[model samples]
Target chain A: MPLVYAGVCSHAPGITGRKHLADPGIRDAFYAAFDDMRADLEASGAETVIVIAAEHFANFFMNNMPSFAIGMADFYDGPIEDSDWLGIDKFRAPGNRELSHRLISEIMQTVDVAYAEEWLLDHGIAVPLHFLTPRFDLPVIPVNINCQGPPLTPLHRAWTLGEALRRAADAVPERLAIIGTGGISHWPATPDSGKINVDWDLDFMDRWCRNDRDALLNYDDLTVYADAGQGGFEIRTFLAVSAAAGGAQGTVHFCEPIPIFAVSCTIASYDLGLLDI
Target chain B: MSLYYVQKFLYELNRSADLQAAYVSDRRSVLDGYTLSDEEIGALVDPDIGLLYVLGVNGQILMHFAAFHQIEWHDYLQRMRDGVDEHGPVREGVYAMTGRVGTGECG
Candidate 1:
């Protein structure tokens, strides 16, 4: 199956339903974009979706956590955020055991990847899952990354892993789609820290969709981008997704800063180049 | 000092409620029982301990129990190893709807 790839957010900053949290204009735009991406995934003839994202407190604690988790549950649940932005109780998706097992073995042969038989789908996974396939009807393969810890893998490592995933998908006789979620640019801490580095963020996003792995990995001061503000350098997920997309270029959907919580509520979609790939 | 050292020292101090009282009665005995080296003891009481003691009682105790006085790190690792042997390693893949949280959040 041709791989349909995308970058989606579960909590689009202001969209989360706290009266103090919603930005009607951006929220509208996010929904519209979500619908468009869902249509795109459908058009790509995707049979299974491999979602690469992170876990909040759901599957990780202050203690032990793996750098990666492959979903093995029969179904994965989406989290509800109390507020309307994400209050929708739950979304469920079927698990693809055959493809999931194949991908895990392929990944482990090259790196120390972990297999989580029991992992609760956190907002990181749920938010995007809810947006793309709202009914939770799709069969999904969720990959968890340790985006918030020490001994944090390098950008190159994330790229290599994504490349491995690309290979894994190519090997799957069944059709597959890939979704990479988390962060456009919002610090989440210290309200004012959410300023979008428009120039840098856009630059990274541009290069990311093109699968410019070497360029991204070789960037002289990635930590500065990661530490420069609250965006937390999670833009790397996009880079990872781009690698899976076989380096397709992108077109912007929504790009603007929603400063209510001091985070830039930016959302964009890249052309997955199904025909070209 | 490393974050680990500072956290360990503060943790030990909080584990014993009578630490201050015990220190006053006989510092050597308290130090001896924990097998703390002279350097560790010196570092613990140093006025410049900085943020080591700022973790409050509970934080201190937890850190101490984790690092020095309680279960060994190898034991926990062993448990993980044993679990993997018994239940198989945590498998990774696309899951159906399963959002386990709170007490059973992490495996």
Candidate 2:
């Protein structure tokens, strides 16, 4: 059976490697985290990775959509935006078809979705990929959850999808690793700009990496996610990763306040039961 | 397998309408393609899938309870592994309810 190693990721343009190259402090943290994660990923021996995430307008437009989408491509590349901050134009990653198609067909019964044979790498993927497997050498199976608009899958649904993905991965008989990307807190709009929910955000990170769903599920009613904060959606991605990790405890690598933007720059990794890969 | 539970959940969510239509319009197609009976779809989860899916489900999420009406972890994992045989639109309009990706119809 395959093993899942998952965690929450920050999507702020300033913290992610592709968008923020000039800031020395953040750049170092980002690179160090990437190196550590890459070594861990390489050590894990997982030839395939299934990434669960929420897309920010990187590819899909307003008209065409999929609640759940799987990416099956021959090669995947990144650096979502080409800001001078990051000199590198692109990096490589692997793609798998047999697994992606199987997962898509399986997800149809629960919700409407589609299969994308091609994809343009975005920040959500780029940031994590840069750290987990910078070489982009491993084949990746991308799974998407629509977190932006109405009728979006609730946080709970996102978690379920993670499990479904795990099932899909396990059936393959291949060494597999799973990662969920998004956030814990920090809304990205001007009106609410500079707002940071330290308590709620920090609480989310603590409970999540610890695999404490009881603490997290209770927050469905928490105000930080609904009115004062827009992170409720992104938080779902974190839950998915926790779910994929099968309740494995995680260690927090770094957590610090990001200026101007309410987004927190944090990095952490979870325990996947398999031996390295 | 909790077929009855899944049936009730589907009815409540109006997903049953889709299932019914799938069943009536193309019996064999639905059976071979997308429909996985309770008996058929309950075996895929070994440890990895079970842990991931269960992580998403706390014993308390309202939908989790509601979902229990139809199938359980075992069955869901099996469906994930086997997939459906029927042909249908992979993308539909309901996904637009949430706007992460662009929304449109897929035929």
Candidate 3:
């Protein structure tokens, strides 16, 4: 089956961890958007969701990092930070080793990818799941791009990974939903944590919604760092989703700069129905 | 100088509850295994959020270390700013502070 859903969202730890500090008006609005995304995802009847996230040194470290990796475990446990600190309780989400095996087998044909039997979910995957799969009933296949460490995966290669994922998804019988989660333009974890570049974010989202490959791939890391802060590096996740959308246009459901959350708090998806697949 | 090892230690400590407990019980024992300068060792043992930030430890790794020590979010941000104020700029890595600090813009 073709991908049932394709979208992107923000997954900063602050989104869940520091919600109490944000303005109630904007916070509720963002929460409502997430709820709407959940509704759309459920309406798609997606059996499993493939979360493409840029993990912040949770499982993969500099010692041995894969440019791209997919989860292949029966169960995955999460939020690694303290429950009180992240404001999300520790929970184990289900995974299907056999299905992952099949998907990995397919995705590997085109892109050299790593498969992990054990994955500890960090906020990159945790925060998004907290809203997208609140019940933890749906199986999830976690994907990671090297966004944290230097020598990160190049943007073009990230696009290839998306194409590989779509090909793999199409090969499977189960309806798959893919979501890319990361910040657009903000500095996370440092003293400048909540600083957001609204203009940079808007420009990037404009490129993303148009599915303009050249425009999206045009950004260099140095320019992105100067304009969008280090967190902008995570745009690889978004670009991959754009590539997975396979030229279908997108819609920005919600986008607002919520400083306390440390991102432009966004929710957007592709019009996958436009594709003939 | 060995920012990699410094981050490696925090990376391990952040993920393992057992290591966190062991480090809390005997930090020196845990510190002995890794090749670390006295400053790095002090930063790890004292768990100085600011000094560690200045030493070029990625915020993603340093934030959990701060949380483990029970540092509040705002306090955590303030400590990093204080670290930079006293220690000059980040000596290495891509996480160097580029924006103005203490501008009341960030939370």
Evaluate every candidate with DockQ and list the scores: 0.03, 0.01, 0.64
Error of 3 at A212 (Å): 0.5
Q: Is candidate 1 or candidate 3 better by DockQ?
A: 3
Error of 3 at A237 (Å): 0.5
Residues A86-188, candidate 1: write the lDDT tens digits. 3456556788776788878877776667777665565566666666777788888888766644445566767767777877777767777777776655433
**Across residues A4-82, which tens digit of lDDT does each residue of candidate 2 receive?**
4555556554454224324567657755766776677678777787777776645553446567777977766665444
TM-score of each: 0.66, 0.64, 0.97
CAPRI rating of model 3: medium
Q: Write the per-residue lDDT of candidate 3 for residues A1-277, one digit (tens) a residue.
A: 9999999999998888999899999999999999999999999999999999999999999999999999999999998778899999999999999999999999999899999999999999999999999988999999999988889899999999999999899998999999999999988998888888998899999999999999999999988988888899999999999988899999999999998999999999999987834
Model 3's alpha-carbon lDDT is 0.91
| Model 2: residues with Cα > 4 Å off, grouped in runs | A16-23, A77-80, A83-88, A106-112, A189-194, A226-228, A260-262, A274-277, B1-107
**Candidate 1 wrong stretches, greater than 4 Å:** A6-14, A80-85, A191-194, A219-222, A225-230, A274-277, B1-107
What is candidate 1's lDDT per residue for B1-107, written digit by digit as tens?
Answer: 23334333443354345674675576555555554445445544442221122211111122223233333323322333343344332231110012110111111
